[model samples]
Target: MRTNLDFSPLFRSSIGFDRMLNALEAASRTEMVDNWPSYDIVKTTEDDYRIAMDVAGFSPDELTITQEQNMLLVSGQKTNGEEVHYLHRGIASRSFQRRFELADHVKIVGAGLANGLLTVDLKREIPEEMKPREIEIKTNIALPKAESRQIEAEKAA
Candidate 1:
């Protein structure tokens, strides 16, 4: 069962969050949920992440990994060989494409395929200007005092 949420009220009150809200709305509206080739996302450290996907029947040459500006695309194309009769068809060998949305400054460091698992490593590299900085505070600075002079009124001018 799926429920649709109305974001009209939030759209009227929020500012500068249209992109985020639109992404949420689009995700919610997706009718077909494809769970093929299960994957896992793990955070190894504060700035490092890893994604492991199960691609049992795919080889390195049959798979393609692409990294766009803020997106990561993984696709697999199975090549058909000579037909062979099988008593039981238990394994899946179909073409599939999966997309992952990446955060700002996140980059793909490396990728490897071993033991039927495709592992992708990512690291977040924040720019120097965007990183948080400490500000120095000065204390006890003295200001110069104004000169005061005594003025005597002219006596009986």
Candidate 2:
């Protein structure tokens, strides 16, 4: 059974969070039927992350990684080779595409393929202006006694 979530209340109260809410709603509605080429996401540090995927039969040239705005796309396409018949085929070498939603400043650092595993590194680099900063509070200086006396004399007059 699939349940639909209503984000109308959040929409009414939240500001500048439309994209996040929309993503959540879309994720809830999507049915992930294909889970081939298993992958894992791990956070190495406070701002570093890694995505490792098991692409056993895919070569470096057969895989593609692209980043656009807040979206990361990874795809693989096997090249046509000599056809070989197998009595019991088990390994999967089909084409597949995977997508990941990245945060505001998350960037792809590097990627490597080894031992049939594709590893992608990511780091979150917050801009200087966007980083948290401390503000210095200024206190008002006290008025001079002569100025206070002049104001009192003028009021008396």
Candidate 3:
């Protein structure tokens, strides 16, 4: 028996968008994707961001955070505790993995674990040219402000 794969549809589609190409490239990196421990991405500021995850029952030693290219990965493992007898068990302390796709120029500021929440801070430093700046408009009226102010307030004050 012979199995066949088709690429006719993909080849027939229009190819002009850079974003679409990037998406295809990212799809090839499925191994980098992580879906564990539940997480939330919050936008703190226009150029600042934070990631909070519920990493309960995981110690700092078992957790590892690293940045690969423009990706943030967080992995943790549950260490084996001392032998004991349990009549009933309900809590989950299994290992987990989480991944975050970061934007250009986005850098991790720091990370902290408090209570049962693990928070990671990220900041993007925009260039001076890219930042919003007020442009000065030049005009032909070169009169002094002192005289112009008195004339404009003749009837007001």
Question: For residues 1-157, could you state the per-residue lDDT of candidate 2 as single tens digits?
Answer: 7889999899999999999998989888858677888999999999999999999989999999999999999999999999988899788999999999999999999999999999999999999999999999778977677743434445553
What TM-score should be assigned to candidate 2? 0.83
Show pairs that collide, candidate 3: none
- The number of clashing residue pairs in model 1 is 0
After the best TM-score superposition of candidate 3, give how far the Cα of residue 39 lies from its true spot, in angstroms: 1.4
What does candidate 1's lDDT look like per residue over 1-157, in tens digits? 8789888788999999887787788778956879988999999999999999999989999999999988999999998888999899888888999999888899999999999999999999999999999999898989799899999988995
Instruction: Mark the regions of model 3 whose C-alpha exceeds 4 Å error after superposition.
Output: 1-20, 24-35, 132-157
As for candidate 2, its clashing pairs are: none
Model 1 vs truth, CA RMSD: 4.6
Clashing pairs in 1: none
Could you tell me which 10 consecutive residues in candidate 3 have the lowest summed lDDT? Answer: 1-10
Error of 1 at 28 (Å): 1.5
Cα lDDT tens digits, model 3, 1-157, are 4334343466468576555556565555435544568789999999899999988878888899999977898988877889879798655677877777777679999999999889999999777888799989888977776644444445664
The C-alpha lDDT values of all candidates are 0.92, 0.94, 0.79
Question: TM-score: which candidate is best?
Answer: 2
Model 1 lDDT at residue 91? 81
* TM-score order of candidates, top first: 2, 1, 3
Select the stronger candidate by lDDT from 1 and 3.
1
